[model samples]
Every structure is written in structure tokens, then in C-alpha cells.
Target: MKTLQVDLGQRSYPIYIGSRLLEQADLLTRHIRSKQVLIVTNETVAPLYLQQVLDNLSDFVVETVILPDGEQYKTLDYLNRIFDTLLTHKFSRNASLIALGGGVIGDMGGFAAACYQRGIPFIQIPTTLLAQVDSSVGGKTGVNHPLGKNMIGAFYQPQCVIADMSVLSTLDDRQLSAGIAEVIKYGLIREPDFFAWLEDNLESLLDRDVEALAHAVERSCRNKAEVVAADEKEADVRATLNLGHTFGHAIETGMGYGSYLHGEAVAIGTCQAADLSRRKGWLTDADVERIIRLFKRARLPVEPPAALDANRFIELMAVDKKNVDGNIRLILLKSIGEATLPVGVEKALLVATLNGYGRKG
Candidate 1:
């Protein structure tokens, strides 16, 4: 078992990552003070690992609400269902919520817990690799609105994050690839050495090598934890973590929710950011090629969705959360291990880059 700690002062918590971390009752006993417990999951995951969590929390009064799985279901209407479930049960502030699925369930459950009587305790049992490495770490929780992804959300931290790698065995290839995209981001944005490390061990990771997966999960969590500890509310330094998000969110939103996986869009978006950097002479083509090569190895999409047009792309991006005043503040590449926000990217350059987006037809 591998344990990574996210130190947020009083709100600090542990993210337990390993093969069988899910079945440990004591893993959650310390943080859950309530007898009333609600475990939130989706249809797909409910059939898989819900029993493990329920058995672990047998001492507590466990209630459940299973939503249909997918990005399209991540909306206010679905989030309201959680409220309805909690209200129907008469769960009080003393109650606790457990997010037992992937990022969607975790975000919605955490948000529901945060708003339920001005915040109650919640635990994150992130089942997906993407959820374990990204959503389960930063404490950013919310449901997506039609206009943007995670545009309407809160920075509510969970009491703890339990990441059981064993659950990942049931995940489909696309979901696994979505996770590797995030792991790649941690390397590209913060740790140059880690980036090199990924370049060396791509095959082992793709094969689900236990040691590789554990190290990747731990290192990615560590990078995110450091950023969260430094800037909990994304004041400035933390926004760098949004590296390819401005364009990626637009891709996800414009393509609609389910067209591409969140990490799939992010994979292509990172490629685009690197391309933009190369165009501006910020990153060498060699650097860009290496980044794309790694994404390909993970089976992640490295090209944008073909349906996007430059005008629509720009219009959607204008509304990104990272935009300040009227100008879009993009997190572009500086090098393999570094990134930054250059003041105002040119319109022609942005349009041409969008026009040149290459991917499967």
C-alpha cells in the first residue's frame, strides 16, 4: 500500500493508493464521525466495488444513490438528485458522504456534502485512475453547466481520498488512457525528471505494471498536493496546473459531454498547447514531438476533434475560467518540465492553430 498526504493545514487528508486499499474499514473510521453515511456511485461502478465499500462501512448507517455513469450526466439536475436523496433520508450535519465512483461521482458527492447544511464530512474513494490522480487530490468539486466544464463548482476538500488500484482492473481502456493523460501533465508541468522517467517506462505503465502505476499515482498526487498546499484557491501559482485546460474544456464543451473523454480532450489539448508554444518559438519541435510520442504510447488522443472550427473554438475559450478581464490567460509550455501564462495570445495564431488541428477523421 502507498500513502500520499495532502497537507491543507486543518483540512489535510491522506490519499491511500494501492491494490486493496478499498476494503479497509479502519482506513475511513478515523475521519467519519457520523452514523448516517451516504455512499454515492454510478450504475457501472455500483455493480463492481460498491459491495466492498459497503462491507467496510458496515458499522455505519449506509444509504446509497446510484446515478447513471458518463460525462453527459454530470449536471445540476443530477446533482439535485443527491440533495433529494439526502433530504429523503433526513441525514443531518453529523452525517457523512462517500464518493464511491470516478471523478463525476466524487465531484458531485463532494459538492453535495459541501452544500448540505454548510458542509459535512465526505470521503473520496476514487475508482478511476483519472479520479485518483487528479479529481481526488485538489479538493475542487462541482457539477458542470452546459456552457462550460466545471464552470460552476467549489473548492471543497474531502476528509480523505481512498484510491484502490484493484478497482482499475475493471476499467475500460479509454478510462485507463484518460488517467495516463493526467499523469503526463504532472510530468510536463512540474517535474522534468519525471517527464524523462515517463519516456523511459511507457511500456511498463501501459501494461499496468504495479510498481509503475504506484509511482505514477504517488508522484502525480505529490505534485498536485504541493500546488494545493501553496495555493489552495488557485490564487496564482496553482493556476499553472490548468496547463491545457482552457482549450481542453472548450473541446469537451463544444464537442458535447460524451463525444470524448475528459482526459482524451486534455491529451489533445496538451498537444495543441505544445504546438502553440512551438509556433511562438517557446518550445522546440523536438520537445513537441516527444510530448506527442508519449501521449500516443498511452493510447490517448493527441489531436483535436475534427468538427471544431476556429471561430467556435475562440468563442468558447473566451469563457474559460482562466480568462481575466477580457483576455484569455493560457497556460502554455516553456519546456518539458515547465509552463507559464503569456499575456494575450494573438488571434491569427490561435485561429491558424485551430485550423491546423490534426486527428482521426
Candidate 2:
């Protein structure tokens, strides 16, 4: 097992990444603060791994909330179910929540821990690749609002993250590909050598080579931990982590959630960001093509939906968290490895990319 720390001083926590970690009860039990525990998972994951987690918590007063699975279910309405379970069971502030599914479960479970009795302890046992690499490490937790994605959330850290690689064996091909999108994001935003490595070894990752998957998860988590430690609240460098998220969030909110998986939308949005960067003379035509090819090779979508035109995208993007005083700021690429922080671009230029970048002339 390899352990990495988030390094938030008082809030610091370790992320345990390895195979069959669920079999290690101590890795999870040591983090729980009290006897009362709530395991928030979804219907899809409950049958597969819930019992393994339950096996570890046999001594605690445990309750389970099996949420309906999908991005569409990640809302204030569904989040209240966790609260209902907590309140019905009269769980105390010292009680810990175990988010035992993918990103939606992690986000909602963490948010519940953050809001219940003002705060409580929680641990993340992220079952999906997307959650393991991105959502689980960062303290950013919340449900999606109808107006914007992740607009109502908090920067609440987890007690510890258990990224058991063994659970990924049950993940479908599409969901596995979705996770690779975020893994690829780390390389695009900062790790140039990692990006080059991905170019050569993506096939190995697709084949679920144990060493390659472990390396990708560890390296991606390391990159995320370093950035979060420096700027926990996204005051500066942290915003760079949202490289394609602004446009991607727009896609999620515009199309209604779950139409595109979060990582699929990010892949498309990053391609658009590369297009805008090319327009601004930051990336060449070859650079844009290279970026698109990688997402394609990963089996992710690289084109924005035809249903969302420039005007609709603009409306949706205006509601983003990164926007300041109605100005829609975006994280664009300066190069393959270096990403610019959120910056305001000319509306005309932005419109041109939104209108022309992915559409046939």
C-alpha cells in the first residue's frame, strides 16, 4: 500500500492507494471518530462492495443509505436523504460518514458530514476511478444546483481516502475511460513528462495493467495533493485545476446532468479550451490536434454537443463559480503542460471558439 498526504496542517489526511485495501479493516476503522456510522452508497455499488465495508464496521452502529445511481441524482433533493437517515438515526456530530461509491456519493456524503451539526468526521472510500483520482482527494464537496454545477458546495477535507484498486475490476469500460480523462488532465495542466508517458502507455492503462494503473493513480493524486496544499480555497493556483471545468460545467448544467458523464464533458471542454488557446496564439494547430487525439484515444468525447450553441453555452457559463461580477473567466492552456489561471477573454474571441471550434463549416 502507498500512502500520500493532503498536507492541510490540522486538516491533513492520508490517501491510501492499493489493491484489496477494503480487506484491511484497520485502514478505515482508525479514522472513525465514534460508534455511529453512516455508509452512503448507491444501488449499483451496494451489491458489489457494501458488504465488504460492512464487514469492517460490524462493531459500530452502522446504517446504510443506498442512493439511486447517476449524475442526475446528485442534487439538494437526494442529498436530503442522507440527512434524513442521520436525523432519523439521531447520529451525533462525532459520527462519521463513509462515502462508499463514486464521485456523487463522495460529494453528497462529504457535504452531509460538513453540514450535519455544523460539522463531523468523514472518510472517503472512492470506488470509481474518477472519484479516486480527482473528487476524493480534494476537500471540495457539494451537490449540483439547477443553475450551476457544484455551485453549492464547501471545501471540507476528508479524514482519509481509501482508494482500493480491487473494486475497479467491477467498473464498466465506459466508466473506466471516464476516470482516465481526469488522469490525463493532470498531465495537460502541469505534468508534461506524465503526459508524454500517457501518450505511450494509454493502451496499457486501457488493458488495466496493474503497474500502470497504480502509477497513474499515485502520480495523479500526488499532483492534486500538492496543488490543494498550496491553495486550499482556490484563491490562485488552485483554480488552474479547473482547466476545462468551466466549459465542462456549462455542458453539465445546460444539457441537464447525467446526459454526459463528468469526465466525458471535461474531455470535450478541454478540447474547446485548446481551441480557444489556439485562437489566442498560445497553441498551434498541431497542439490542438494532439490534445483532441489523446481524449479520442482514451475513448472520451472531444466535441461539444450540437444542441448547445454559443448563446446557450454563454448563458450557462455565466453562472460558474470562477466568474467574477458576471464575467465568464476560463482556464485556458498556454502549452501542453502549462495551464493559465482563470482569465477573462474577449467575448468575440470566446464566441468564435464556441461557435466555430467543433462544428462543421
Candidate 3:
């Protein structure tokens, strides 16, 4: 297993990546606070890998809660189910919660772990590529409010993150591409060289070349860990992580959640931001072309979803957690490997990009 440490002082933890890491007891034994464990997963993943995880913990008492699949279920109602299960089992503060699926599972389970008895230790066993690279780290846990995406989360950190790459084998092609969008983001915001590598190795990534996937996942996590360690609460430097999120969350919420994968929505949002940046002189047309080219190669939709009207898009963007005062701020490209959050970006330019709608990536 390849381990990456997120050094957040006392809250620091390790993200373990590899095949069959889920079945390794030492991965959990070293981090877990107690023996009473609850493995929270969705219906889609519970049947596939839950038992394998259970077999490894033959020594510890285990309970399983299977939530129905999809982003729509990532709500307080679902979180209540975890609490209800814990209460039923008489679980205490010493017990641990295991997030055993993709991003939704990790977010929801992490949120539940954060709030229960004020807070309890939780482990992120992220199964999807998107989860492995983004949501599973940083401990930004919360259930989405009807009003906005992740509008009600806390800056709570997790005990550890177990990213078992073996889980990617079950994902569909669309799901695979969604994960690549974030992989591409790490390259876009911080490491230009990784972006260049992605441009050169797009086909290898699509083909599941093990070395390429490992490099992509490792570098993305390393970049994120450094960022999260610096700004756990997203005060300044950390906000850069929202590269495509402001527009992406609006797209997901404006139309409806689960209509598009989180990473897929971000891909379109990243493209829209690229266009806006080019118009504002922050990025060149060539830069836009290169970004869209890499996204196209990954099979992600570089075009915005049709349902997000300009006014509604702006409205959603207005309430973004990243916005300061009334002006919208965005992580725009200075170039492929570098990005910046320029405040007070003109609304007209944003509208133009949104209206560009079907522009080919």
C-alpha cells in the first residue's frame, strides 16, 4: 500500500492507496479508537465489498447499514438513519464509523461521525475514483441542504482515509471519467507538469494503466493534503480547491442533484471558468483549447448542462460558500498548471460563457 500523510498537527491522518488495502486489519487497528464499528455503505456497494471488509475484521464486532444509492439521498434524513442505527446498537462515543462507498457515502458518513456526540472517530474507505481523489480527504463533512450543496458541513477531520484502488474495477465508464475530472483539477490548479502528463497519457488513463492511475491519484492527494494542511477552514489558500466547484455545485443544484456526477459537473464548470478566464485576459485561447482537449480525451462533458439558465446560475453562484461580500470569486486559470481566485469577475462574461452552451470541447 502507498500511504500519504495529511499532517494537520494532532488531527493529521494517513491516506492509504492500493489493491486489497481494505482487507488489511493493521490499516484500521492503528487508527481506530474502539472495537464497536459501524460500516455505512449504499445498496450498490454493500453487496460487493462490504463482506470482504467484514471478513478482515473477524476480531471486532461489526454492524452494517446500507443506504440506497445516489446523490439525492445525501440528506439529513439519511443521516438520521445512521444515528438511529447507532442508537439501536447503543453505540457510544468510543465507537467508530466507516464510510465504505464513494463520495456520497464518505461525505454523509463523515458528517454523521462529526456531529454524533459532538464528534466521533470515522474512517474514510472511499471506493470511487472521485472519492479517492477529492471528497475522502480534508474532512469537509456535511449533508447537502435543500438550499445549497454542502452548505451545512463542518471542518471536521477524519482519523484516516483508506483508498482501495481495486474498487475502481466495478465502476462504469461514465463514472470513471467523472473521477478524472478532479484528477485533471489537481494538474490545473497547482502542478502544470501533471496536467502536461495527463495530456500525454489520457489514453493510458482511460485504459486503466495501473501506473498512470497510481501517479494521478497520488499526486492529486499530495497536492490536496498540502493545501488542506495549510487552510483547513478554507480561509485563503484552500479556497483554490474550489476551482470548478462554484459553477459545478450550481449546475448540480440548479438542475437537480444526481443529474450529473459531481466530477462531470465540475468538468463543465471548469470549462466555463476557462472560457470566462480567457475573456478576462487571465487565460489564453490556447490555454482554453488545451484544457478542453484534455477533458474531451477523458470522456467528461466539457459543455455545461442545458438546464442551468443564466439568472439561476448566477443566483446559485451568489450563495456559494466561497463567495465573499456580494461579488463572485472564481479559481481561474493563469495557465494550465497555475490558477488564481480573482474576485468581482464580471457577470456579463459569466453569462456569455453560460450562453455558449453547446460549444465543442
Candidate 4:
């Protein structure tokens, strides 16, 4: 097992990445603060790996809450279900909640743990690549609001994150592809060499080569851990992590949730960011083309959905949490590996990019 630490002083925790980690009870139980445990998962994942995790926590007084799976289910009503279960079982703040599925489960479960009794400990057992690489690491937890994605959330870090690469074998191609979007984002926003490596080894990634996937997860997590350690609250550098999130959240909220996977929206959003950057004369046409082509190679959408036009995008994006003082702040790339959050982008330029980039103009 390879361990990477997210150094947040007292809040610090190690991310354990390897194959068949779910079976390691010591790795999990050591992080639990009390005798009680809540394993929160979705319907799809419960059948496959839930029993195994329960078996590992055999000694703990454990309860399970299986939520209906999907991004649309990430709402206050469903979040309350976790609280309902915790209360019904009389779980205390000493008890630790285990998020046992993908990003949605991790987000909702972590949020539940965060708000329950003001705060409680939670561990992330992220099953999907997207969750393993991004959501499960950063301490950003919340359910989606109708107007925005991840708008109602808190920055509550997990006790530890367990990413079992073996579980990835069962994931469908679409889900696997979704994870690669975040991996690509790490490269686009920070590591140019990682981006080039992805350009070269993307085929290996698509094929699910064990080494390639492990490297991707470790590298992505390393980058994320460093950023989180530096700017835990997104006060500064951490905002770069949302490179494509502004436009991506607009797509998600406009589509009424779950219409497009978060990573899918991000892939399209990154393309939009690249286009806007190109418009600013920061990136050459070839640079933008390379970005789009890499996303296409990863089998991600390189264009925004047709249903939401430029005007709708503007309305949905106006409420983004990253906006400062009513002015929208965006993570725009100066080059492939460098990003900056520039404020007060002219509305006409943004509208033109949104309308022209992916639409049938």
C-alpha cells in the first residue's frame, strides 16, 4: 500500500491506495473513534461490496443506510435520511460514518457526518476513480442545490481515505471515463508533465491497466493533497482545483441534476475554459485543440450540451460560490499547466465563448 498524507496539522490524515484494501480491517478500524459505525452507501454499490466492508467491521456496532443511487438523489431529503438513521440508532459524535460508495455517497455521507452533532468523524472509502482522485480527498462535502452544484456544503476533512483500486474493475466504462476527467484536470491545472504523460498513456488508462490507474490515482491525489495542505479553505491556491467547475456547475444545475455526470460536465467546462483562454490570446489555437483532443481521447464530451444556451449558462453560473462580491471569478489557464482566477471577464466575451464554442453556430 502507498500512503500520502494531507498535512492539515491536527486534521491531518493519510490516504491509503492499493488493491484489495477494503479487506484490511486494521486500516479502517484504527481510524474509528468509537464503537459505533454507520456505513452509508447507494443501492448500486451495496450489493457488490457492502457485505465485505461489514464483515471487516464485524466488531463494531454497525448500521447501514442504503440510499437510492444517482446525482439527483443528492438533496436535503436524502441527506436527512442519514441523519434519520443515525438518530434512530442513537449514534453519538464519537461514532464514525463511513462513506462506502462513489462521489455522491462520499459527499452526502461526509456532509451528514459534518452536520450531525455539529460534527463527527467520517472516513472515505471511495469506490469510483473520480471520488478516489478528487472528491474523497479535499474535505468539500455537500448536497446540490437546484440553483447550483455543491452550493450547500462545508469543508470537513475525512479521518482517512481508502481507495481500493481493485473495486474499479467492476465499474462500467462511462464511470471510469468520468474519473479520468479529474485526473486530466490535475494535469491541466498544475502538472504539465502529467498532462503529457496522460496524452501518451491514455490508452493504457482506458484499458484499465493496473499500473497506469495506480499511477494516475497516486499522482492526482498527491497534487490534491499538496494543494489542500496549503489552502485548506480555498482562500487562495485551492480555488484552482475548480478549473472547469464554474461552467460545469452551470451545466449540472441547468440540466436538473444527474443529466450529465459531474466529470462529463467538467470535461466540457474545461474545453470552454480553454476556448475563453484562447479568446484572450493566452493559448494558441493548437493549444485549445490539444486540450479538446485529449478530452475526446479520454472519451469525454468536448462540447457543452445543446439544451442550455448561453443565457441560461449565465444565470446558473451567477450563483457560483467562487464568485467574489457579485463578480464572477473563473480559473482560466494562461497555459496548459498554469491557471489563474481572473475576475470581471466582460459579459460579452463570456457570452460569445459560451454561444460559439460548442453550439451549432
Candidate 5:
């Protein structure tokens, strides 16, 4: 097993990444603060791995809440179910909640922990590649609103993150491709060499090569941990992590959620950002093409849905967290490996990219 730390001083926690980690009870039990435990998972994952997690906490007063699976279910309404379970059980602040599914479960579980009794301990046992590489490590937890994605959330760190690679064996091909989108994001935002490495090794990842998967997860987590430690609240450099999220969140909300998986929307949004960067003369035509080609090779969509016109896209984007005083700021690429922080672009330039970049000509 390989362990990485999110160095947040008092809030520091280790991220355990390896195969069959669920079989190791101590890795999870040691982080629990009390006898009361709540395992928040979804219907899809419960049948597959809930018992394995339950077996580990046999001695504790454990309760399980199996949420309906999908991005559409990630909302304040569904999040209240976790609270209902906790309140019904009379779980105390010391009680620890274990998030045992994909990003939806992780986000809701963490948000529940953050809000219950003001605060409580929680551990992340992320079962999906998207959660392991991005959502699980960052401590950014929340449910989506009708107006925006993740607009209501907090930066509550986890006790520890158990990224068991064995669980990924059950992940479908589409979900696997979705996870790779975030992996590719790290390279585009800052890791130039890693981007080049992905160009050569992406085939191995698609084949589910264990070594390649581990390397990608570890490197992606390391990049996340480093950035989070520096700007836990997204005061500066952290905002750069939302390279394509501004446009992507707009897609998610505009499409009424679950229509496009989070990673799929990100893949498309990143491509649009690359095109906008080209318009600003920051990246060449070749650079834009390279970005789009990678997403296509990963089996991800690089085009925005035709249903969302530029005006609708802009309206949705204006609800983003990164926007300041009604100005829709975006994280655009300065180069393949370097991303600019949230910056407000000229409305005309932004409109041009929105109308022209991904439209069928």
C-alpha cells in the first residue's frame, strides 16, 4: 500500500491507495472516533461492497443508508436523508460517517458530516476512479442546487481516504473513461511531463493495467494534495483547479443534472476552454486540436450539446462560485501545462467561443 498525506497541519490526513484495502480493517477502524458509525452509500454500490465495509465495523453501532444512485439525486433533498438517519440514530458529534461509494455519496456524506452538530469526523472510501482522483482528496463537499452545481458546500477534510484499487475492477468502461478526464486535467493544468506521459500510456490505462492505474491515481492525488494544502479555501492557486469546471458546471445545471456525467461535462468544457485560449492567442490551433483529440481518444465528448445555446450557457455560467460580482470568471489555459486563474474575459470574445467553438459548422 502507498500512503500520501494532505498536509493541512492539524487537519492533515493520509490517503491510502492500493488493491484490496477494504480487506484491511485497521486502515478504516483506526480513523473512527466513536462507537456510532453511519455508512452512506448508494443502491448500486451497496450490493457490491457494502457487506465488506460492514464486516469491518461489526463491533460498532453501525447503520447504513443506501441512497439512490446518480448525479440527479445529489441535492439538498437527498442529503437530508443522511441527516434523518443520523438524527434518528441520535448519532453524536464524535460519531464518524463513512462515505462508501462514488463522488455523489462522498459529497453528500461529507456534507452531512460537516453540518451535523456543526461538525463530526468522517472517512472517505471512494469506490470510483473520479472520486479517488479528484473529489475524495480535496475536502470540497456539497450537494448541487437547481441554480448551480456544488454552489452549496464546505471545505471539510476527511479523516483519511481509502482508495482501494480492487473496487475499480467493477467499474464500467464509461465510468473508467470519465475518471481519465480528471487524470488528463492534472497534466493540462500543471503537469506538462505527466501530460506527455499520458499521451504514450493512455492505452495501458484503458486496458486496466494495474501499475498504470496506480501511477495515475497517485500522481493525480499528489497534485491535488499539494494544491489543497496551499490554498484550502481557493483564495488563489486553488481556483486554477477549476480549469474547466466553470463551463462544466453550467453544462450540468443546464442539462438538469445526470444527463452528462460530471467528468464527461468537464471533458467537453475543457475543450471549450482550450478553444477560448486559442481565441485569446494563448494557444495555437494545434494546441486546441491536441486537447480535443485527447478527450476523443479517452472516449469522452469534446463538443457541447446543441440544446445549450451561447446565451443559455452564459446564463448558467453566471451562477458559478468563481464568478465575482456578476462577472463570469473562468480558468483558461495559457499553455497546455499551465492554467490561468479565474479571469473575466471580454463578453464578446467569450460569446464568440461559445457560439463558434463546439458548434456544428
Candidate 6:
């Protein structure tokens, strides 16, 4: 097993990445500060791996909340359900919440732990690639609001993150591809060599090559950990991680959630960001096509939904968390391996990019 650390001083935690790491009791038990444990998972994930986690935690007092699976379910109402479970069980502040599914569960569970009795310990056992690489590592936990994705959330760190590659075998193809979108984001933002490696190895990753998937997960986490360490509160540099998320979140909320996978929307959003970069004379047409081709090769959607137009996109993005003084800040590419954000882009250009690029005719 390979362990990487997210250095947050007092809040520092280790991310354990390897195959079958979930079967190890000590790895998880050592992180739990209290004897009480609340395992928050979804219906889809519980059937596959819940028992394994429970077996490892047999010694602790445990309660499980199996949530309905999907992005649409990530609401304040559902978040309340988690609190209800905790309250019903009389789980104390010392109780630890274990997030045991994909991003949805991680976000909700982490948020629950953060708000429960003014914060309690939580561990992340992310089952999906998207969660393992992105959502699980950084302490950015929250549920989506009707107005925005992750609109209501907190920067609460996890006690530890356990990513077991063995569990990934059960994931469907579309779900696996969705996770790769986040993997691709790391390359687009800061790792030129990693991007090149992905261009060559994306096929192997799609085929579920163990080494490729492991490398992708570890590298993605390393990149994310470094960024989060630098700006835990997203005061600066860390916002770069949302390279395509602003446009992507608008897609999720506009489409009414769960209609399109988050990673699919991110792939489309990355294409749009690349297109906007081209319009700003930063990326050449070839660069834009290269970006699109990589996403296409990953079986991700390269075009935005036909139903959303420039006006609708503008209205949706208006609520973006990165906006400053009402100007929607965007993370645009200066090159294939570098991104710049908080850009005060022209409205007309944004409108044109939204309408002209990545729009399905």
C-alpha cells in the first residue's frame, strides 16, 4: 500500500491508496477517535462493500445509513436525514462518521460530520474513482443547492482517506469514465508530463489496467493534496482545481442534477474552457482539438447539452462561488499544463463561447 499525506498541520491526514486496503481494520480503526461509528453509504455501494467495512469495524459501535444513490439526491433534505440518523442513535460529538461511497456520500457524510455537534471526526473510504482522486482528498464537503453545485458546504478535512482499488472492479464503465474526467483535470491544470502519459495510457485506463488506474489515482491525489495544502480555504491557487467546474456546475444545476454525470459535465466544461481559451488567443485551434480528443477518447461528452443556451448558462454561472464583485471568475488555460483564473472575461466573448463551442446543434 502506498500512503500520501495531505499536510494540513493539525488537520493533516493520510490517504491510503492500494488494492484491498479496506480489509485492513487497523488502518481505519486507528483513525477513529471514538468507539461510536456511523457508516454513511448509498444503496448501490452498500451491497458491494458495506459488509467488508463493517467486518473490519466489528469491535466498534456502528450504525449505517444507506442513502439513495445519485447526484439528484444530494440535497439539504437528505443531509438532514444523516443528522436524523445521528440524533436517533444519540451519536455523540466523539462519534466518527465514515463516508463509504462515491462523491455524493463523501460530500454529505463529511458535511454531516462537520455540522454534527459542531464537528466530529470523519474518515473517507471513497469507492469511486472520482471520489478517490478529487472529492475524497480535499476537505471540500457540501451538498448541491438548487441554485448551484456544492453551494452549501464546508472546508472540513477528513481524518483519513482510504481508497481501495479492489472495489473499483464493480464500477460500471460509464462511472469509471466519469472518474477519469477528474484525472484529466489534474493534467490540464498543472502536469504536462502526466497529460502526455494520459494521452498514451487513457486506453489502458479505460480497460481498467491496474497499474494505470493506480498511477492515475495516486498522481491525481498528489496534485490535489499539494493544491489544498497551499490554499485550504481557497483564498488563492486552490481555485485552479475548479478549472472546468464553474461551467460544469452550471451544467449540473441547469440539467436538474443526475441527468448527466458530474464527470461527463466536467469533460464538456473542459472543452468549453478550452474553446474560450482559444477565443482569447491563448490556445490554438490545435490545442483545443487536442483537449477535445482526449476527452472523447475517454468516452466523455465533449459537447454541452443542446437545451442550455448562452443566456441560460450565464444565469446559472452567476451563482458560481468564484465570482468576485459579481464578475464570474473563470479558470482558463494559459497553456496545456497551466491554468489562470479570476479572469474578468468579456460577457460577449463568454456568450459567444457558450453558444458557439461545445453546444450540441
For residues 69-98, could you state the per-residue lDDT of candidate 5 as single tens digits? 999999999999999999999999999999
Deviation in Å, model 2, residue 322 alpha carbon = 0.7
- Local accuracy of candidate 6 as per-residue lDDT tens digits, 1-361: 8999999999999999898898799999998888899999999999999999999998899999999999999999999999999999999999999999999999999999999999999999999999999999889999988777898989999999999988889999999999999999999999999999999999899988877889999999999999989999999899999988888999999999999999999999999999999999999999998999999999999898888888899989988989977778899999999999568789988998998995545
Candidate 4 accuracy as lDDT: 0.92
lDDT for each residue of candidate 4 in 129-199, tens digit (9 for 90 to 100): 99999998889999987767787989998999999999999998999999999999999999999999999
TM-score of each: 0.97, 0.99, 0.97, 0.98, 0.99, 0.99
lDDT of 1: 0.88
List model 1 lDDT by residue over 275-324, tens digit each. 88888788988999999999999999888877887778898898887787
Q: How many Å off is the CA of 191 in candidate 2?
A: 0.7
Error of 4 at 18 (Å): 0.8
Q: Candidate 5: lDDT over CA atoms?
A: 0.93
Model 2 pairs in collision = none
Ranking by lDDT: 2, 5, 6, 4, 1, 3
Local distance difference test scores for all models? 0.88, 0.93, 0.87, 0.92, 0.93, 0.92
Predictions: Cα RMSD each: 1.4, 0.8, 1.5, 0.9, 0.8, 0.9
lDDT of candidate 2 vs native? 0.93
> In model 4, where is the ten-residue run with the lowest total lDDT?
340-349
Error of 6 at 199 (Å): 0.6
**Residue pairs in clash, model 3:** 192-337
Off by more than 4 A, model 3:
357-361
Error of 3 at 83 (Å): 0.4
**Which sections of candidate 5 miss by over 4 Å?**
none
Model 2 C-alpha lDDT per residue in residues 255-353, reported as the tens digit of each score: 989999999999999999999999999999998999899999999999899999999999999988888999999999999999999999999999999
Error of 3 at 361 (Å): 16
